[model samples]
Target: MNVKQWMLVVCFLCSGTKYIPNTCRTFGSGVVQPFQGSGFYVRSNCPFTLTRLTHNRVECDVSIRRGKNGLLVQVEIIINKVRTVLQNGNILVEDQSVSLPYDHTYENIFQYGIYTRLRSSLLPLTVTWHTVPAGIDTLWVRTAIFIRKS
Candidate 1:
């Protein structure tokens, strides 16, 4: 098949394929791991400090190979062992599931990215991820924190 025809075929076949959780590789301080089940849990170490003077931006990149039917992904800022999912103006809806971009067909997989800004006033906050495992399996979930200090 020609280039255009080959591309069309690829897309047609990939639409039914599952997503893949790519490994994390970025500049920041966080962890990217996998978990199972529909329960909620923490994904970071407590007592973590952010940029000293300026604001910090945290990004959560997740890829799903086979998403669960009722999967829900939520994030929280943990402080002193307190679990809080709301930060600044971030919203956590009841059906907050990992949604891949519409044009995410390059690799025949689904990917979701989340960005959140952290103010200096929220220093010493522990950023954690809580999500239900994908329908297939959890591979890699990368979380990056960017700031002048880091």
Candidate 2:
């Protein structure tokens, strides 16, 4: 083969024509209870209500109302099969006074491989939150998820 032919072969091999799986599942939202006045609390048992529907996408939205004191909301997203952590951290919003509200939304791509891995697996993803100020008597949070279509 000539040099030109060899280059063409290499280019074809490196082309981005490979097919990628595009299947994902999503979970619904739920409420999270906050700690009592002037104290710390960890929400490890927070549950994500998942639902199977059209389109392969994942979406989550959380809202919170802090009382007189400020509060911190922590969220974590994980892909169980690959043992990967997509997102993990905390979002802190201060309550200037009573009824301080905050909202957050997240979306991710779920390919075929990821969808299959999570299909029969429990705890495919997890989210957690905690209150900051000890005096903050109220904490409220909600979450949701979506998966893409195959």
Candidate 3:
């Protein structure tokens, strides 16, 4: 197929995909790796934080406007943590390290489900995305966090 035709085909297939627990904007702290963070739905412009409702210090006075990137996940982090989320699904806790552009705009460099889960270290969070595991699991959080150490 040509570039235009290929683009349409890609969009059609991607539209069917959704983000797990990609709704919550004002999310609390802590990890919901076990609970799957929440549920998935059609993608939107809102950002997602991998915080569970049951964690302490849940209510964060996070000024989203100050978020270096267009995502709050990066804002919540004070510094860079040992690059959370290993290639094998391990998470580095309390790692403040975040990598993102200073601009508040987002770019879909990997809209085709590149990462199983989004890491705090990454910025301009993937608002509209689909992970490979979501196909086999309904309670899957496309951008879920992992508590276990690598």
Candidate 4:
């Protein structure tokens, strides 16, 4: 098949494929390595701090490959124990599940709860992911945090 034909086929196959937990933007490339993860810990004074009912959005871009063994990827947010913030956001707390397809890129956003406790502040957060079936390697998992100023 020629380049244009191949592109059309891909579009047709990918069309109407609903990815769970939709976000505002998606970008990046490459397959994610199993067990490999990275995240950012924002200090309270960085730029913005979350307040009650406020929105904190996170964008995650991951790539995966179909190896000899299939696997499932799970991503979640980790809040520092010191902080008393409560997450009252979306219930679909995780990203959409994706299957390996000749090494393609996938991206999604997660909206989490803001600080609910009045006495607590300076919340530190991070993103984490793990693969099921235990042995498949993840290419890369990266996260970016955006919070509204209180």
The model with the greatest TM-score is 1
For 1-150, candidate 2 gives per-residue lDDT tens digits of 799857855664566333232222211122233322232333333333222222234333332322222232222233221222221122222311112122222222223321211121232232322322332222222222222333
Model-by-model lDDT, in order?
A: 0.28, 0.28, 0.29, 0.26
Give the TM-score ranking, best first.
Answer: 1, 3, 2, 4
Worst 10-residue lDDT window, candidate 1: 101-110
When sorted by lDDT, best at the front, the candidate numbers are 3, 1, 2, 4
The regions of model 1 sitting more than 4 angstroms off are 1-72, 80-82, 86-114, 120-150
- Model 3, range 2-36, lDDT digits (tens) per residue? 89857855674566633234343332222123332
TM-score of each: 0.20, 0.19, 0.19, 0.17
RMSD of each: 16.0, 17.1, 16.3, 18.0
Better of 2 and 3 by TM-score: 3
Clashes of each: 3, 17, 8, 11
Candidate 4 or 1, higher lDDT? 1
Encode model 4's per-residue lDDT on 1-150: one tens digit a residue.
Answer: 799857855664566432222112111122222222443322121112111121244222222223223332222222221111112122122233323211212222232232111111222222322223442222222222333223
Model 2 segments beyond 4 Å from truth? Answer: 1-55, 72-125, 131-150
